[model samples]
Target: MRIARWTVTDLIHDGFVIDDRVVEFPDGLTVADVLARGLSATGELYERVRDAAATPLADIRLLAPLVPAAVRDFVAFEEHVEGVSAGVEGKSDVAPEWYEAPTFYFTNPHTILGPDEPVSPPVTERLDFELELAAVIGAAPGVGQANLTAGDAASVIFGYTIMNDWSARDLQGREMKVRLGPAKGKDFGMSLGPWIVTADELAPYLDADGFLAVRAEVYVNDELVGEDLVSNMGWPFPELVAYASRNSCVVPGDVLGSGTVGNGGCLGELWGRNGSLTPPPLQTGDIVRMVVEGVGELVGAVGAHVAAPQLPRARTRTRARRR
Candidate 1:
């Protein structure tokens, strides 16, 4: 089953997408409400409205699935890390610490966009996209919650969605040199949607190692630039979530992304493979799309570029510090 947050004319709703129709949940039933009720609520709710009238899929506007309580993107794929380190940071190998535990950084959940939205590039020089998958907190129904171990991370997973961690390479590479951020460089824009595919739906694709054997691909202006298997992650989703929930609580709505996939998953990673200079950054009007087997796709357009504006004197730090 799929859960979608969408708008039909003037009516906004969180509902089930069955066949070519949308059967909205009753009033006050927000994404948070359904999440709190666990995975079973989706089926139960759908059963209640199976015969009810639903809006056609093409008539509604899909919004960012839900505003997460928090969002953390983990570097769970070694191929992605090794490639990015070599290309972006000029490191020939990933740091040893990466193998020890799941590492991640929080991103702005407030700027999340849904399918078909326009994304304004923070920097036109090196705007890029990361193909990823996000695991929302809480298992479907009939599961344990607190004190989750990597062994049980699968039990608590609510569902999964595709993610496009939009980035400004120039801003990111510059700030990361100070050993601090990918914050301003990131956090400005991201895309998440098509809809959430429940964990139960993906069980059939799970390999013996627990990794889902799903294909992930990225396209620009309808051109297929990269593709990789979702099962290729060195550290699976469970381990990443298990590490995230350690001692601390990971409640409903909290999201953890699978980070970028293998080489060429992003333009920067692709540069690492070309044996040459980086490709041209995204220009206004470019369409970036990500497709994950079973999880659907995310599409966004590059909005017209805006020039950086002069800011208050107190904020001169952005330009004042000389390297």
Candidate 2:
């Protein structure tokens, strides 16, 4: 089932997409609500809404599928990491530690935008988009479940959605000099949706090796920019999820991003390959469209850049004398 949230005439609703129409869920029920009950309940919920009155998808405004409980984006594509590193840091080699385990960083969950929304990039000259697939976590067997094995982690995934991890490259480059953050560089905005396609709906696309062998593509201002297969990732979603739960807990509505795809997912990768910016960074009015087979398409428009105010410098002070 394809689940979505949308607004019509100032009223918001939750529904499931069937063909070109949306079947509204009962009042007060949402994708998050269903996910909170666990994936096993989805079959029954679908039966309840499968025959309801429907609305044409074109008549309503789509919203981000759900407000994520938390967002963890991983760098699971080796080519992407190498290309981005070469572009940003003048290095093309993948870090050795990257091969040891799946690594991820938390991104802001509050600023998520839905399809067709405008992204006002933070003061930046290098605004870029990351083509990624995000998995939404469903309820676990019990609250605070931790140390899940890869197989168990797979069961907790509810569905998949397209994501655009909007970035401010210049800002990211500056902050990482301190070895700390991709914070302001990344936290400004993120895009997810069209809708979420439940896991069962995508099972047919899974390869024998357990990778989702789906094609992902991205376009800028209607021009095709990049494409890759999800199976190309160095680590699959199950491993990523399992790593996320190592000594920690994953809750319903937690989103895990598959990071950027290789071969043109972003301008940085292109720069890395060509040794210069070819297509250039995103600008106001540019529309970014991302498609993941069996999932959905997510479209976002770049709005005018919002200039950030300068931060006051911290005063230098000598450490206190030893006690």
Worst 10 residues of 1 by lDDT: 138-147
> Which candidate gets the maximum lDDT versus the true structure?
2
Model 1 root-mean-square deviation: 3.9
Q: Which ranges in model 2 have alpha carbons more than 4 Å from their true place?
A: none
Per-residue alpha-carbon lDDT of candidate 1 for residues 183-270, written as tens digits (9 for 90 to 100): 8789788899988888889989899999988999999999887799988887778888878877776778888999898857888877
- Give the Cα lDDT of each candidate: 0.82, 0.90
Give stretches of model 1 more than 4 Å off. Answer: 139-147, 311-323
RMSD of each: 3.9, 1.4
Mind giving the per-residue lDDT tens digits that candidate 2 earns over 1-323?
Answer: 88899999989888788899888777578878988887678778788879888999889999999999999999889889888888877879898999999899999999999999999888888999999999999986633588888899888989999999999988999999999889999998999998989998899998988999999999998899999999999888988998999989889999999989998988889888788877899999999999999887899999998987788898997887975
